[model samples]
Target chain A: FRKRQPSVASLIQGIRDGDKTALSRAITLVESKNKTHLVQANQIIEACIADKKNTLRIGITGVPGVGKSTFIEVLGKYLTNQGKKVAVLAVDPTSSLSKGSILGDKTRMEVLVRDENAFIRPSPSEDSLGGVARKTRESIILCEAAHFDVILIETVGVGQSETAVHGMVDFFLLLKLAGAGDELQGIKRGIMEMTDTIVINKADGKNKQAANLAKIEFTRALHFYPPKENGWVPKVLQCSALENEGISEVWQTILNFKDATADAIYDKRKYQNKFWLLQTIEDNLKMQFYEDTAIQQQLEQLTTLVMNAKVSPFVAAEQLLALHQKKLK
Target chain B: FRKRQPSVASLIQGIRDGDKTALSRAITLVESKNKTHLVQANQIIEACIADKKNTLRIGITGVPGVGKSTFIEVLGKYLTNQGKKVAVLAVDPTSSLSKGSILGDKTRMEVLVRDENAFIRPSPSEDSLGGVARKTRESIILCEAAHFDVILIETVGVGQSETAVHGMVDFFLLLKLAGAGDELQGIKRGIMEMTDTIVINKADGKNKQAANLAKIEFTRALHFYPPKENGWVPKVLQCSALENEGISEVWQTILNFKDATADAIYDKRKYQNKFWLLQTIEDNLKMQFYEDTAIQQQLEQLTTLVMNAKVSPFVAAEQLLALHQKKLK
Candidate 1:
């Protein structure tokens, strides 16, 4: 299959016609780092987005030990059973740590793995975090083109990748353990404020009471937080993925959120779209400046001087920027 | 004074010789909007920073009615009595709002006003926040050149100006009222993380007990926050500027922070200096791009398309950037 490469036209057609193989191939093409493949990948992406379907994009995140896979499995199976096509994609930028930890154990997702309507893919490794994020964002278009009604993007909540995931998703769900004290330290400071919902997992046996206590604490804490721009108050609830309890309620909550903020969510997506454009321009401008040989040399010496307070950062930056502009002119 | 323009060499010499008039004039030059004065201002700044002294730069912020002026006046008089020369500068970008609210009332700071070793300047009116921040940061150098041992920058705690102040200051002190609920609403979130010390003011009269309770709550909350990069935990304390109480202890706490993180603080300043240089370059590049007439025309059209989702932001940005780059080449 690698030897007989399919054309971009056929690939787009297959994706529109709901060919799973074409969808997988398109994602692989986007994940490829080869120069030639990049050109073709962008072309395919452009075509896919032209006829893009509106899919529900949900981002799920939690620390390593917080039962993310178990929850995703239960949720994915539940959705598939309701005749909804689900695609599970991972955006683990720290690919080294979560290489085999997520989605590798097929038995963990036993019920969903056997279902024809479900698709699961591991995170793309061997790329920069930006690269991974860009690929994952592009892959969402391909997944939707293949008629996936629901797209769940899973990311490890320990690193900077959560911000990237948050930028691309419609609804952000933070999974937590019963004991919020120690585990909360692993999460970043502003993560809670960005969260749309907080789910306390492992609510069975002795942990049930602790989970209930956590729900109350989180609810009270969130009340003190400034309201999000969309006016959706973040909800906190407990679930035992192991017992498959409270699963439907979580789904209902999500539906309610969508209904309540239906008008505002479109505005949010438009904002995200425009934000990515500006972000790309900013990143590219910085890249261009740093790649210049003259600027890089001045930067090294200026960095030392600024560090020692021999010169102010503002003056040093002005000098460096002037040099770059002169070279450009 | 505005009619007689001083030579850059004379201003530099006067600042080095501890002349306050020269220092104030230098600050005015730096704040000038005239194109001709900009070149001279840069030259004067270059000279001032060449032999800049390490002054203790402290940033103070709080919402309206938090007794910011009273606290500063008490703190300023206390420092000057201990044989330290102090300079108080305001970084209020919204000068319109705080014109008569802060320091404008001479009776509020009667003691500090009569002190020979103190200097107080209002915020520069009719300038952008960036413009105000730049001028205030430059003014710090001028103050230090005149051998001021301590510099206190005042800013309202409501907007983006706090982050700018945080970028330029060595230690950040947040002034809060005893009423945590109403006062907290005025202060933005994520700000407490940036503070080095949280000072609860107006702790006299009926507010004393409430102040102590608020202190305990803040201390407990800080414990959950991530430790700062320099390993210094943010301290929360109650003070009664009205009664001139806890003034010495607050100074003692500041000295202790200086002693404990002496080496790390120097490194942090250097990092800040270098950070500003990069930031200046980034801002300038964006400004230049936006200023181009052709690109501005393209940007307006692309913005509407991106916002309406008629075109993807990535693609729209690519088109706009390509147009600018083509014109540049």
Candidate 2:
């Protein structure tokens, strides 16, 4: 016989009492596509928001082979050792297509996965980055309510995932492999602007000298960027997740950033809240308009006419909007 | 007595015959906010769309003091001397507030303003960037119909104007002073990614060596960026717009870029058309939602609640959207 599912009230109580199982179940509800589950998830989210403890949300990103998993594992363990309740989540939108990449294998985190104070969750399988980001954001609140003092969001630094992760986190860490030519090829266009710290990973063994040089190169490169709005200058450091070296220094830099930008952090979160409020409404509005059968039928024809310069894009947009409004009526 | 307004048919015929007066009048209609003028503007735009000649649209941007007006003057004169019809336009969203900082004074381009083969138009006074961009885009079609072989769009690079200009043009040019610390300040985060060429201005006499050094620095910096989507690599050039030196080289570089990216240009324009279609629709949708008095009344309260973590932003958005839908019903 299958076990009975717990009610929303019991789940909330358990999460408040720091029950990892209840927190995971609540997050599952948040990730569900079912209509009833959505309503229940919102209720849980509402309750959790009020009960949330002080939390630090850090987003870590790097290319696929940049050792993001190893770095995260070591950092998560470090925090747990400091008596912090740590929660690890991934935001890989491509997970659904890749059948789960980052954090998919629980064995990747080995020691951290087995730790009593650590909770590790794989990315939700979602077709859209927006969907995955929403799930991860909600999970953050749920994790916080479960008394997780530190929440680490991991994403592969490709496509628009870094941007999504950047929006949700307090500090954004970009991991890079030394001598990988990332610095020479340039990091992605906008990624550097969003980064708070750059960590050159695998800085052990033969890679030590190269990693230091890479750190210096990145430091000089970071100087070119305009001052960040939060008034915290971005720093570059070298680390070796393999040897477990410089991990504490990375953590220390983050603490320094947090201390220096305390007021800015409050303002950033407020701005992020407003951004999400508008973003969600806009996303839904577009989905409603684009999903309409009548609009879809005309969109292709209108797109062709606009592309060929036979009709002004503005006029075509006006026509479709009129049709949508008429359908609504 | 007021002169009689030209009929839409006459205006179209005149623009087709390369009449500057007709082109100017049509653009005025495009910029007008009056409902009747808007209708007439659409008719003229529809007519001109079919009559458009093969034209190259180049967007030039720099900070206010970076000699944008002088550069455009020199470039426009060069193109006109090459037996090409040139039209210069500006897209300054801040024009209304700044009392028209750019291209506001026709005397700034005194030589080009007097050339029968060239037409210059100041930016329309619009409160929003979208409004100004739409006007400039429609004006481009009208100018192309007027047989202008090349269109020059100028914008101040301090804000989102460059992005608006970038979206509408076939080529994007960034102008900067040699030692203005822009290269060291990193140029704007995403500006370099969109640029096809960087022109270091005022590279004459005392500034020539510094300009060349700046050029080398920029070339190295540009290497760090990933290869652009269009297979063509960006080039850096130094020019003294005041002395009209290197102006021809700038033109040559543009010609070379056009030759190399001819196919990409076609594809880019198609993509831009679709982008504008969706952009126009989305902008309108947002306007409709935000402008509703009832929605505005509740938005602030919801924003505060979301910022304080009392309500999920997603939930607040849903509540507002439902209210909006119910009101519509």
Candidate 3:
């Protein structure tokens, strides 16, 4: 008998039982833009929060062709072989712009895709910043509820998506190619600073020497950067997805990092949650003001006036705020 | 006749006539937090905007002991000797916090203070982000209206103020001391990218060789950074404010940069004005929302709840926003 409808409680129950189908449906709810789905998504997240399980959220980021998919596939298989359940999810906002998802293709990680212990989900198709952030974060909660101990969140290092992923994850890994012109070009400054571990991929064959040189260069470069709050120095490692080499070593480095910064990480997560709360409030407030019809009508004209320097920015802002206030009355 | 009343039109007229006293008064009005003074400030700014003159706005940043003041003094004197009026303004928010203003003190620049062609103003006492940015930017307009052909806006490279300074200036110069530990310590990443010219200060005497070495290192380091939209390569120069050597060369570099990126600089200012307009609106909206009494009252509890993971950040934000919306109704 096919069940046409299911209540939110039953969905939560199924997810708690580690049902992959329930996990997928739960993520769909969170990713949905519909108002009814959003409410249900919040309810599901609330229920999951009450029964939260521990998750090692690792964020992986690299430029395309940096072997990110291969590295993830190898790493995912390694963990699954160790008897840990793995879920690989993506937060690639650019995927929608490119007309297809980067990690959404099922063929890329064929082994991981078919592995019973491993689940792969692509990024939601939504493009709104707030919407995407909300969905990805909620999906993490659902994934954790489904007892996925190792959740790998993949994102392209090109844009603001790296920042979003960095905020949500416990560990942030930057995958880079060896001998790529100092291994720094095309990398954003903030993203480099946020990187917890720099992994040089495709280091198996003749590239081994270059990768080793890169490891030294990155080590020296990272030494110039101030140590993060956790006091664990960011490390550079060499890995070869083709040979399935250094996969466990990277995982061990992550474990050592977790051990070294347990207290700071715990406090950081709490602080981050509080930060997101305030940030959400700030964003919502701005959205409300900007969305007000009166403010919207005057925005273009005021912008032109400001561009022409006919009015000071502060005064222009006051005028718009006054318009919103007056209209509210 | 003792006249205490100066209408906005007369103030603008006096400013246009190069009356230093009138310029100072206009700047004071712009810096004022009083609601009444704000209206007059806008009028003065509006009138001054119409008569905007061609001025070279350079943003200079360095550490406290990086010879920033000495460099400014030498460079200011150099420009003034060439029959150019120079205005040096500090955006050192910390100076106010430290119980003394860096540029506010007249004794620091004994020669420049006494020079008829130079004007120096310290950071405003108000510490709010919007207040500081608004005051400094408006002061630039008043200084330009008062016939200051060269405006050197100084900010400590340690904070967000440098970014604000960079936004309003045509040229952003970073002053560094040679042999100062690679000369990159404590400087933020984004700051380096925004720099149009990196000047190695104190390059005279025994520091000359180290300064040259630092220049080379910086050039190589900067190569890794993406080029700005203006298509001008960021140059590194050696200067000694102590001996007044390289002052002319630095000025020449500025001239060359102006020649190379003239159109882009012009477009940048217009785009910056539009950006500031939108940014100011967003800030004001957030301030209004955050300043709501009921929302403030519940903020601490909500933050703790979010931190404890008892509630999702979005739900907490929704609750707070709903409360504010209900109160408005």
Predictions' DockQ, in order: 0.54, 0.65, 0.59
CA RMSD of each candidate after superposition:
3.2, 2.1, 2.3
Better of 1 and 2 by DockQ: 2
Residue A82's lDDT in candidate 2: 95
Q: Which regions of candidate 2 fall more than 4 Å away from where they truly are?
A: A1-3, A98-101, A180-182, B1-3, B99-101, B180-182
**lDDT tens digits by residue: candidate 2, B1-329:** 75589999999999989999999999999999899999999999998886645679999988878899999999999999989999999999889898855787999999999999999999998889998999999999999999999999999865788899999999999998988555657467678888899999999999998898999888877766667878879999999999989999999999999999887887888788889999999999899899988899999999999988899999999999998887766
User: Candidate 1 on A277-319: residue-level lDDT in tens?
Assistant: 7887777778789998999888898888877767776778788
Which candidate number maximizes DockQ? 2
Greater lDDT among 1 and 3 belongs to 3
- Residues A1-329, model 2: lDDT tens digits: 75678889999999999999999899989999999989999999999887745678899988878898889999999999999999999899888898955787999899999999999999998888888888898899999999999999999865799999999999999998887555646478788889999999999999988898898888877776667877899999989998999999999999999899987776787788788888999998888899989999999999999998899999999999999888877
Q: What's the alpha carbon RMSD for model 2?
A: 2.1
Q: What shift in Å separates residue B198 of candidate 2 from its native position after superposition?
A: 1.7
Model 2 residue A28 CA deviation (Å) reads 1.8
Question: TM per model?
Answer: 0.91, 0.96, 0.94
Range of the 10 consecutive residues with the lowest summed lDDT in candidate 3 chain B? B180-189
lDDT at position B258, candidate 3: 93
In terms of docking quality, how is candidate 2 classified? medium
